[model samples]
Target: MTKVFIIKFSIFILFSFILSTVSAFAQVDVEKMAKNFNIYLAFPEKHFQLKDGKYSGGTSPQDFANVSIEKIVIKDLNGDGLDDAVLVTVGNYGGSGGFYELTALLSTSSGLVQTNSIVLGDRINIKKIQVHSPEAHSPPELGLIKQNFEILIYMLKHKPNDPACCPTEPTMECFTIHKNKLIPCKEAPEPPVVKKPALYLYPIKNQEVEVEINPKGKVLKTIPEYREKWKVYVTKNGKINGKYNYLFYETTLNAPIPEYQRGWVVSHKELSRWFDVTLTKFGLNKREIRDFKAYWLNELPQFPYYEIRPLDTQFVEENLTIKINPKPATVIRVILHFKGTDTPSKLEEPAIITNVRKGFTAVEWGGILENSPNSDIKPQAKYSFLAQDTGVVVLRAIDLREHKLSIKLSSNGCTDKKALKSIVKKLEGINSQVPHYEITLIREKPDRCKALISEGTTIVYDLKEEFGINTKLPYTVTVKNPIYPLITDEPYFQFFPKKELKPKPVEEDMSLKEHLIKATVRAIEMEIKRYETSQQRDKEDKIDRLRNEIEKFNKMKPEDYILGYPNGAESSMEMFTYGPLMPPIHRQVEAIIEEPLKIGSILKLTTMTKSGPFYHIAGINENIDIAKELKQGRYRMKLYLVYKREYFGFIQNYYVYIAEVEKQ
Candidate 1:
């Protein structure tokens, strides 16, 4: 009986060992299963397809190039005593960007079969995937595993605040298999709100201190500051309630001094010593402190203060000049203002002042009236100065403030009526001239006008016509030429010849020329065969046309030929037609007169002649002479006409000389 029992036990142990080994082998191959799941998804067939059918069944398997399995998790989900598969795949379709999907496949006796699929979202990212662990619950409960361990997929979802390429929100999705179907389970709770730490600066007596505080307003720590004038800076970590992980220190000059001291000046050497001591107290090594001190010395400003003062209150020609006490490393800006307006208005664009030495700087204001008429100076105008790190100061004009003129003007001796009359008569002689008057005041000293004329000066003056001259001028002039009709030949039609029209030679075929000949022979044979097979009477006519076309092509040359048709209707007929011909190209004409004419001088055409098809100053140069003697005249001293094709048969340019006159 003992021997029989031992034999039975031995057989039982052997059977158990074999069964265990087979079970181990039966376990699912994760990589192989993932590939099969990807194919089952049929991504390639959906992405690339023709209207008639999908492009999926070729000899080679479809790669689904842009689609990839990002992650896979295997676990039992339905109490089936078999591991199930969950795959996260990402597909990128060119312009549409990327999309992510979650796929669950159940293990059956045959193979892994897809039970459920869920499209996550466009441009989503799969962060992680795993079996839902019951241990995650507080005071771990048994009911969490009721669904045979639910599948948990962790992904990054794109929120409104997220960028186009990166997702920002963390999301957890739970799924379970019930009744042979994948169903959604309860979602995990959202993460807790994080608290960030910040650094705040507060004034302590005569010094400043930096204190780090948590989001709840609780003090974390105080960053040590060696010098009373030093400032501390901190940067927060990535999380919303994250701690500040970085800190830096900088020396400042805006710190207030002790109340006991009225005024104190600190030298550069003393400041350097203080900086080194402060850095050392902050736990900086010798090398670091030395380097920081060197940097501070190099970056220190040379001058700390600037001063501006009005040089002259009374300005001539609306000019204003100011004196600035120069200081190195300081910038100054000067702006002018017009007074007696609804509000303080700028006289002109602001001027930048830079690169000054220790001496006084002088700034002049002139040409303000011509450049900025909108801000032209009124009876009462003022100027303002602004220095960097300093405030602005406004100063009244000296001349306007005092109600006096710096320069004297006398128009009593300046009169020329005879010259004005001559200019008017000359303008009246020209049909295109428009007569106008312009009076200019000539100053004995160009630099010193009737009023102050400086960099930003604006002068407003009324001209007395009795003491001025009337200048005759034409704003625009048109040159005309007579029209003439001429006949010419124009192209109508042309024929292009073809030397060789043949397909490229294939490696297995003959050369291009020989291939063409063979193709031609084949075409002729086909035509002949068609002609013989057809019962219609027109078949012979078609074959004859094809033969003629071949003959003509064979005899054609390589060059293109052009045929001319002079008449509109008949190609073979040539007829005379009338139309305006292009005008002859002429060189630009210019001349100078030795004497300057008055503002009202008139210019008249003295002669008219014919050249080519037009009559009237044709070949002669047409231009009004501009000379110093004619500077008093506001009108054109010399006129220049540039000939163009559009003026071919309209009008010709005429030249007029101004009569010499004596200056009064």
Candidate 2:
């Protein structure tokens, strides 16, 4: 996890604490100001009446803010000899900007009272504050001289055309007390726009939704301290207070959202208009849409154009694991993942799903702004998985033999051994006697079509040869959350030798060629029967032609096929489940491969366990065994075509399961 933190007031805080403690030792006007002091900002002045140098209050909860005196300098102002206090106060609301103000606490017969202050703008840096009183001076036109002392404020201000984040210009302000109010002798600079990935939650109507969110990344900041969840009585306007309103948090997204394969390529000038149209299409209200734009536009890096896309909303909601009580009737989460580009990119458009705000609705809008395809921002990998591109695999059966750990993963018929990847690392031990190791298996590539043996796919990791583990000793491995206790000392669990664990059949078993032909015919017939009921008429010719091809195999005798595995041998294809044969997901891609390849080239075969694409395959190790059975002659073997899908909505995540070498 790479964390970038800007310590905004580190020095100011330390100095404030020291000054506060020193002032506490002796009763002074500063102490009086720290307690119950009055602040006059505008006419009919609103009294802050601060306590303990800190105050929290506003017109309402929606505009609620927290204010603290960050730094203070003691000096005699008004030429009154009694020491007056110059204070820098910081106030932060529910959102990004922090309001910094320059104020004074003057000593009078009535005690310390806060005078009229000046808005120093957001994120203004104060270098020093000095009180300058000449031996003789004349009053100017603007009602001068009741609390007549000049104040010199040296600070850093943002220059014109500067991004709200970095204010590099050095400037100073001169002020004088006029009728007890601090009047700025110069004009104030515009506030700098602060930015980060801000995700806001809206539950329109009297806190109708109680939300609990486990984000895919670490939270940088959250108002009201996000402890598990937030339950705020939000107003219909989505504003509860000036300082606090709807729940919000900030996090850095490490990469582009994987589900976004298509979106618009827009120029810098088009960002505002693009956000309006796209956000409206994705179901954001007027207020939500406006807020999203306001938060990023000021600091958006200038680019010729940008490639912007959105993650599947359902994917975001589920992956973020948003839980709401009195559940929202509709949940709409929009995140614009964008990268700066040189020009408009030609790409496919994604389908947009619009939502309506009814009853109790939950709306969330955020964005990931990446200046380039590859930036140095390395966010924490707090997410479970990056994307759902891996093939159909749902279960794992693990074993360890010869200091090697083998994981047999459940695959649909398309699962191939080459498509999978695994990594192993020896972890620091939790127990002195038991060695601990961690392993993860990811299907980097998915099987689309291949000769599938019914047994599941097996991937191996050599602990002794690769990671230097003792072969004779027992060890423990962590896979996901489970600690697999591998009792390698017992040789009984090692099943990789293709053990003949099958029962003897009463009749002669079918040959390899006959088995393939029967399953193919049955599957093809089932597929043809399915499309027969569809309204489309063009597929009629394909159905008829496929039916004619299946009948030829049905008419052939099983004894005529010379390629036969020993009856009940482990090398023979078997059903992972029994019943009717399952067909391919796409009838158009159903194929057969027999390009003069030797049996030695056949490394893995997965049997079709479930119906097309939600593929679960039964696997067995027969690569070496099958190779030996076909030796002495260069023979060509036929393979089956199958598909598997996780069936996630709008995301098929299709993969071609190939052979130990087939799909090329």
Candidate 3:
């Protein structure tokens, strides 16, 4: 009996040992699960960059590895505030190639650390999976109920037509829990409460605030108005606009009290209150600190109150001179004068003297030091002294107090190399640099003018007329290296340095062309006027003069003047003319010529004796030609009369008429 009991105990122990060994090797045999799933850490400080295997490149997946990524969200696997990553791996269970495992990585100080592999029990096949709500944080508990965050893992089953794989069949195998631990009862239904996304605000001082949502979160009322120290209302989509009021003050030259105090309005939607500001004051008030005087003030966004920085004031040396020689630039007026100095500290009104050289004038001074208007510096009385010739001005500040500052002043003439150098030196000292406008070129002409020549491109007339740029069409602007880089448009042109050529006097050539044309036109005009005057005199005189001129012109030979040919070639030339005839003669000729000329049956031409011949000429044809006999006073030349060719001695009659040949 003892021997049998001992054997039974040994058998039991052997069976337990076998079970333990199998369990330990079972998980190890399956393909090792992927580890180290992580989301980004604190904002821009600790951010994400794409890793080589599955992500990070250009616009496509195929790009250089190790691209810097901005941000990505991750969800917590359990109820912990920290987030977890989802990953996939395939390998042998115990050997090199057996099973595949899907796992997650959680955030750790050392780096991304692997979390426990979630089991997709009994399925044996998951084509794809996703984890949602990756980055969740714990909230301060305000009640007995602690805030619970959860992550959703979606698994795509590979079995086709299976209820779990077929969406139409609507079947799923889910392994989930209420919080971190497994569900108490697997039969319980998922909660139905809609979890709305909370709004997060990021404000930039003096700029707009931005808002965003993630993880398919919905915001029904993104613009919730909060009225406590300040009020907020929805100004734009998903953003809250707010406005607040605070006291603003400006001190006067008098030490007694500040000049003014009023509520200044401001708007803020930020978590922080401090903001930088600039003030521009315009009013119809006192002269010294009013009307046109503007002070730029910087202050905190929280208050209406502002502290006036030390005034940016510089005095020009009194007697400035600009020579009107060379190319006389349009001088509208001049301003250069001296003024007494005043301390910014104590309160007495700043002195204003006459003829302050203003407008777009530059001033030169050694250095300028101004105490903050709000600071404890005593105000000193200022006096002005003007010396226009030398361009030297002086401003001596005097007070009953012990401190005195005397500054030398010179005109701020950019043309004056020395003064410009000083201005440039002073400019370098300022923090926020502004390029001074020594000159601004503008085009205003036939069109709304354009720059025909700029930095380099050869501008065309049509381009100048239309786009005002040297490009044929409008360009799409793309920002490259923004600051100080040249902006170019398509089709981009390369600029080559061109040798500068001094302009020669084009006025002489232009003047010669203009005057020569003018003279010829004027002479032709004068001849027309003279002819009209002669015709306007007594009818007989006009007729006689016309007749005489016609006779002389027709009787004249085809000289060089008439032919206008230097060699006087007259091989095929024909000449003719006519003039007014006396009444009886004209009446007889009209009776002879009228019916035939009008009917176009025969041609009659009256010509001066000098017209050599009308060879190959014949009477007009009534059917194809048309003419009208002129009354005596309007007699003119015709070239259609018969003529004998002196050299050939050939008589050729042609159907020619004065109307057809000479535009009668």
| CA lDDT, every model vs. true structure | 0.33, 0.52, 0.25
Question: Measured by C-alpha RMSD in angstroms, how accurate is candidate 1?
Answer: 38.3
Q: lDDT per residue, candidate 3, 12-128, as tens digits?
A: 999999977775543332212112122222111111232331233333111112322111224455545444444443321110111223344544556456443333322234443
Q: Which ten residues in a row have the lowest lDDT in candidate 2?
A: 607-616
The Cα error of candidate 2 at residue 186, in Å, is 46
- What lDDT, from 0 to 1, does candidate 3 have? 0.25
| Candidate 3 ranges beyond 4 A from true positions | 1-83, 94-102, 121-128, 134-150, 156-664
Instruction: List model 1 lDDT by residue over 1-664, tens digit each.
Output: 9999999999999999998876655554643554554333322223222222112232211122256667766666555677666777666522224556677777888887776456666577788877754333421322332212466677888665565467888887776554565655532111111111111211112232232211111122332422322233322211111232222221111111111211123343455675565434333345444644454344332323111111122322122111111211221222211112212222322222233422221112111111111212111222112111111111112121121112122112222121111111111223445533322222222221222211122223212233222223232221111112221321211111112122232233223223233333333443344354444457677667657645643553322211111221221111111111111112222222233322211122222111111111211111233353434422322221111111212223211112223232
* Comparing 1 and 2 on TM-score, the stronger one: 2
Higher-ranked by lDDT: 2 or 3 = 2
Question: Once superposed on the true structure, which residue ranges of model 1 sit more than 4 Å away at CA?
Answer: 1-16, 37-65, 133-148, 186-664
| Cα lDDT of model 2 by residue, 574-622, tens digit | 2222122222111122222233222111212121111112212211123
